[model samples]
Each structure stands twice: as structure tokens, then as C-alpha cells.
Target: MEISLILNNELVWDKEFKSCKEYVSNLKSLAPNEVKMREMEAKFLNLVNTDKDVSKYYKIGGALCISLLTNTTFAYADTLGGVSDKLKTIVSPLIELLAGLGYPVTYGMLITGFIMVIMGKKSKGIDIIKWACIGYVGLQFVPFILNILELIGRELRNSL
Candidate 1:
């Protein structure tokens, strides 16, 4: 179902708190438990799934939210792609720097830890090696983690 159509039928989805006073008043109408609130959410998901034009509705909803938040018109259907491209541009330098530095730093740490261990500072060497391993994995694994998160978000959006 179109978001506006649903909102027109039930104001709960459109209920934005205007003030502490309004929030207090609305509290009385709130679902008693998380399950009740989730049932409403399920109804929304079902409606969107049954609606043939849900994608168009999503574009309008996304635009409206972006416009409201930024105080500007932003109704483009390709907004997500545009944002992703911009993000890649912004993050490219950081990724390049990480690729350049991570390997050398990791190797250096490992070598230093080995030297320390050979000099009988076993505890310090092990600590250094542990930190180096963690840092190297984190540096290399960030993109994979982000990919997983993006997949999850996409699935949720598609479900809607």
C-alpha cells in the first residue's frame, strides 16, 4: 500500500511527537507491549508487499524524508545509488591508505614481537603480536563487514 494511503487510514504511523506534552498525551494510546507494536509493523509490511506500486511509493517516501530532513527537494528514484557513489569517492582515499600501510605495519609489528620474544620479553612480544593480528584483520575485514551490512539493509528494503 502507498504510505500516504496507509497514513491517511491510520495516523499512528504519522504521529510525530510535537512536544513533551504531546508525547505524554500520546503515551496513553501507545501499544501496551512490543508485540502489539510489531503487529502494526507487520501489517505495514504486508500492505507494501501486496502493493504493485510500492517502489514508486518508496521513492516518494524517501524523497519526502530527505526533503524534510535537509530542507530541500530530493525525490530522485536513484538517490541511493547517488549516495553510494559519493560515499565511494569519499572513502577511496582511506581505503588506499589502509592498503598501503596495513601490510607494512602488520609485518613490522610481527617482526618486533618476534625480536622481543627472542630477547626473553615473552609477555610483551605476545601482546604486540596479538594487537598486530587484530589490527591487520580489522583493516582487511572492514569492507567485508560493510558488504554484509549493505546486503542486510537491501533485504530489509526489498521486504518492505
Candidate 2:
């Protein structure tokens, strides 16, 4: 009866849903006056599916709602930009580190592992160690094996 939605590794909404169609119909009904709110909610849902940070979406959506209520666009214009800027700042450091390593594949795998670990921790409580271990094995170990094969291929090419 209760549907739980984990957004950005945090529990955003957990409530009972009678039926999926009914829920969607209710959402559609809310779209007329609060179109921005609906847009933000939909975006938030999509971000959750993609394992992205939903906090940024919440901030942007909140700001947009305030703008709609007050008939003031200028005040929240920079706020929307700020959300994007903050996201860039958050990702830039990791990207730079990955670039510096020259083996971005490993870094990308590590990032995926980290995100999975975070999500596991949030959803499953303190027992996230098991989830993290699984993620590491799947992401890191699989790629490491592939990298070894790639190295062997390069060596064979050089010999030929």
C-alpha cells in the first residue's frame, strides 16, 4: 500500500497509493495553475530514476513556485542559475581528478560505485556495507578485468 521513493539517496516521499492510474490522474489535475510545480515534480521523479541529486531540483522548483506566487521573475532568475552552478561545482572537482588520472574509466566506475553505495546506505540503513561491496565488485572488478584484456590486446598489436 505504501510506495517509497528514494531521491538522491534520501526518502523524499513515502505514502500509500491506491492505484497508479489514479495517482497519475491526480497529478494531471494539478498541472493547470501550478504547471511549474508539476514540472519540478516530474523532473524530480526523473532524476530519482537516473540516480541524480534531487535537492537541486527541489530548490529550483521551490524558487519557481515562489516566483509564480509573487509575479516576480527577476528575483528567482539567478536562483535557477545558482542551482546549475552549484551542480557544476559539485561535479567539476571529481571530473578534474578523473582527468588528471589519465584512466578516467576507473574513476567513472568508482563514481558509479559511490553513488550506488550512497543509495544503498539510504535505503537499507547501516547495512550498506554489503551493497557497497557488491557495487565495488560489479563496477570496479569487472572493469579491471576488461582493462587487463585491453592491455593484452595492445601488447599483441604491438608485436604484430
lDDT of candidate 1 over 1-160, digit per residue (tens): 2232255566544333367777688888874888888999898788778886985697679888988998996434566746877888999998899778999999999999999999999999999999999999898888899889988987787787
- Write the residue-wise lDDT of candidate 2 on 27-113 in tens digits: 988776578888998886788677645667766788889989988875334553367568767987885675455445544655565
Candidate 1's C-alpha lDDT? 0.83
Model 2's alpha-carbon lDDT is: 0.66
Instruction: Give TM-scores for every candidate, taking all chains together and pairing residue i with residue i.
Output: 0.46, 0.18
| TM-score, predicted candidate 1 vs. hidden true structure | 0.46
Candidate 2: the clashing residue pairs are: none
For each candidate, what is the lDDT? Answer: 0.83, 0.66
TM-score of 2: 0.18
lDDT of 2 at 137: 52
Which model scores highest in TM-score? 1
